[model samples]
Target chain A: MISFLQIDLPALLVGTLAALVCALIGNFLMLTRQSMLGDAMGHVVLPGIVIAFMIAASTATWVMLTGAFAAALFASLLVEFLRRSAGVEPSAALGAVFTAMFALGVLLLEQSGVARTSFDVHHILFGNIETAIWPAATGLSSLFDANALANLPPQVARLGFGLFIVALIVILLFKELRVVSFDPVFARTIGISPRLIGAIVVALAALAAVVSLSATGVILLVAMMVCPPATARMLTDDLKTQVLLSLAFALASGLLGYAIAVLLPLGLGYEISLGAAGTIAVVAGVFQLIAMIAGPKRGSPRNA
Target chain B: MTEFREILAVLLLQAGYNTTVVMLGAAALGAATGTVGVFAMLRRRALVADAVAHATLPGVALGFITAVALGFSGKSLPFLLAGSALTAVLSALCIQWIVTHTRLNEDTAIASVLATFFALGVVLLTVIQTLKTGGQAGLDVYLLGATAGMLRSEAITLAAFSFIAAAVVAAFFKELTLVSFDTEYARAHGFPVRVLDLLVLALVLAVIVIGLRVVGLVLIVALLIIPPAAARFWTNHASRMTIVSAIIGAASAYGGAALSAVRPDTPTGPVIVLLAFAILLVSVCFGSARGLVIRALGTQKLPRRVS
Candidate 1:
């Protein structure tokens, strides 16, 4: 039998970091009812990534990440404009803008064939976590060593750095995030600009999505951003507990999903790579379903 | 003049039979989605169709596998559509269940369902890809649409479904509008609110089934959402909104399909969505009732509110 750690340590770390990044922002998103924006950003990030590739004429990780950030900022700005300036409903605006952007991305991908250089449409839609692995003799402590770090898949290292940045932002802006999430008007009265904070949070979510998308794909990223926190909320009323519970659930889902994807093929002796990110999404759904049915409190729309 | 006539003729009836059938199917699918979409928009479930669309993927894969196992051609359109219809209805109910039972907002519920269903689909598609038969080639069309593979029989089936959906909506128009605008009042007035609500869900699901052929799953909801939303800019009257939405839907469907026919590389579904998006943008800027330009200039007549 294949050793568990041998095949999946790097994949697990990547998933764990993705879950952590998503859970950090996902908590506030659930609190503020802005979870769906993550979904929209996930959809529209494709065009940004493709555009970045085209302009850079390379598929460097930084180029893709920057492209995704700009795209998220642009999409969120468009949504804000449509809602604030025009009279369009918020959900409709998000649906319209993201779908249009996603379709445009697909068209561009077809026309330019540039996406094939660095992006796989299949991998982008569902993700390819199996490819995240440590090279021979690479160890966690050795990640800092130049030879080992160079051997690391750049996406994994980027996710690690992303998690540190997100953790720092959350730590530094915890109170601001709480106030803005709970009551923007109250935040404004207390001398805080809710718009700036909200923008930062959205930017953070978009950036997290860029980092996570490589491992979890777009739809699964949406699932992670909403389901874990939403499920945690079903089990607790305390904000801190909700955040912690969400992080725990996110990590559990990533690990469990990876286990299922790896074991099923080996057990059945099948020649197939069941999508890892999708399995993680399914596992997260299972967690939410269990929470909704048997959590500490009965869920009601009023609480939301 | 003769050359222009010849070109026009070639573009229309003289085109390949598959093109004509697919175009007709596209038009019907568009009109039906637009008509049903008005109700979805009125009820503020603009993104619920997205959930329904994604939820159908697993069903399509399962349907293919089941058909093959049962000694039928796995590519049977009817079987695949049935599978989609079944899953779509079930998942729509699940979303409703989450919304009515949980503290999560409808958006969260929708996002969860959409993602979860798509996840299940990805798993099933992998299985389908590993099948012994070679019938999985066109199945991915349900992802981005395989308009070139559309045939006369499938188009006929789709058109019939659209007509049936339209008739059902027409039959329940009064009750639907009543419930849409004022659910509590409709309940107070003895409307079977739950029944009517499920009926609308069923109608949306039916249109989505036909839509899978034209636009596939990824962008199918746009067909339901964009045209009706654009129509809302022009009129507040629900009936008039439905009519305008259907017209916009048909126009975009026919026009987009024609353009795709000419441009060999352009997929029919995305082109259709982009066209609808363009129309919505135009409606936002210049529509008579709430056009931004009219509002900016302050020269247009006040929007006539039905209430």
Candidate 2:
């Protein structure tokens, strides 16, 4: 029905954009072998947002974003500190710092009664995009069935545009991200400070989290940041190929999920909450499975 | 003053119940994790636990949705637990398959799994919340948990499960140790290393499920790692480590529950993890083999050669 098409188009658009952005971030995470670090940093953002709200006297979107960004950066720095000084393994150090910080955040939220607020922990974990509208598209029909030209909601369109520009910038500066991801030691020898690159990546990652959290919620943001690139890596080793494959994977999953959610009645009951993020993950997983089994065989054993 | 004593009396009485339930639950969970943590850590799959924990979130969400759809009371702890366990096990299996079939490193495979599954879970959780029409925010409670409301049934189930898990560990102790330290040696000896590995993983999954009610998914991994890690400081033998780890785990559970009871409304799992970490720090400083203070004082007081 025309009505159904109208309803599903926005879901597809937002989901697709979210997945695309996640895949872009995921590529770099995969290359660095810091995939779980995304989850750690994401949870670490909880306290950041809570602190921001506490100080700002409001949960205004920008204020929360700034807080989440600072917290994420702090978590990244904390991990680095633990790794260098405490001699903790990177994953273990991440575990220590983030979990501790999150516990503190939870305690603070409980004390402040933020857990009961509208923009509370629950909403932040699983986002509510139902009321999320594209501000620029007021009184506009962004969907046309004849040519099947489905336009995105205005704000979503802008976000996608911004995301595309960011992706483009990263691509133009691909050398920077690649050098930093591939060999920090070598990059440092050749005048690139891995530390600086790491800081930039962390900053950009936090920025991505801030953007995605509005849609996906804080908990699921890491999925977008880690899944696509990881799946792409299963099929290819080259960084460029991985990024390309990740983007493709993200797009396919987002579109497919949106289509499925449209077709199914469960959308009415449960909202298919994961939307694009879930779809991207599932698709990436499926792609990995296919690549693992059907791809060309290698003679080398696994733990070798 | 009388009102204060009455409140104190009620809390102390509740503390007795909380301590017994939580310690038994933590010990059971700790024993299973200690048994499995050894192999995963030995295999250099330490981060795999993180991945598995992250991946399980979707399963928990899915389980909750399924329970709701089936018209079951949302508070059906067993159903929720079952749903989470099923998804977690499936995720683990998927990870194993990916590792075997793909050229991706263990770390990469685990990371990818962690991300995708967790993302899916987050998205679903968001969707669920958005769609909710009323006051029942069932999913939210599972995030950090409110152990103050833990029922008798939940405690009993954890204890029973823990005992069975411990029994399994005891029966297979020799085989697990042999296989874990040297899978190649086990393979040469025709010890079915793959089967043993699967058994150990199953035990780990069981521990995770049992702990879900108490610690929830996010922090349960901490309990698994910290207790055994602390116990490691005290003992070199695997069996002893498992026993001591369970003791440390149980002590923290009891201690945390008791403290929370006394202090009214403190989070139990974090407190327990803190307690475990405290034990670890203490053992690290004063335990026989690796105690820093003893080593430092030993170095200072050593009978060095006169020359």
Which of the numbered candidates is closest to the native, going by highest DockQ?
A: 1
Candidates' RMSD to native: 3.8, 5.9
lDDT of 1 by residue, B92-129 (tens): 88998998887877777887888888889988887778
lDDT of 1 at B291: 81
**lDDT: which candidate is best?**
1
DockQ of 2: 0.29
Clashes of each: 0, 6
Q: Once superposed on the true structure, which residue ranges of model 1 sit more than 4 Å away at CA? A: A1-7, A133-145, A183-189, A298-304, B1-13, B182-189, B263-265, B300-307
Error (Å) of candidate 2 at residue B171 is 4.1
User: Against the hidden reference, what TM-scores do the models get?
Assistant: 0.91, 0.77
Per-residue lDDT tens digits for candidate 1, residues A1-304, read: 1233334777777777887788778887767777777788888888898888889997667888999888887887877777777677877888888988888888888779775665666777777777776664344556457766576666777788778888889889988988887788999999999889877888788888888885656766888888899889899877778888898999899989888987898999988767778888889999999998888764763564
Clashing pairs in 2: A126-B126, A127-B126, A273-B123, A273-B127, A274-B123, A274-B124
Candidate 2 lDDT over residue span A1-304, tens digit each: 4444455545556666767776687677666766666666667787887888889977555777789878887877766754563334455556656766666666677678776774555455554434344333333343433233423344355347547766876878789789889788889888988777776666566666666665656544565666566566656657898889878877876676556544454645644444444554556566655666664432124432
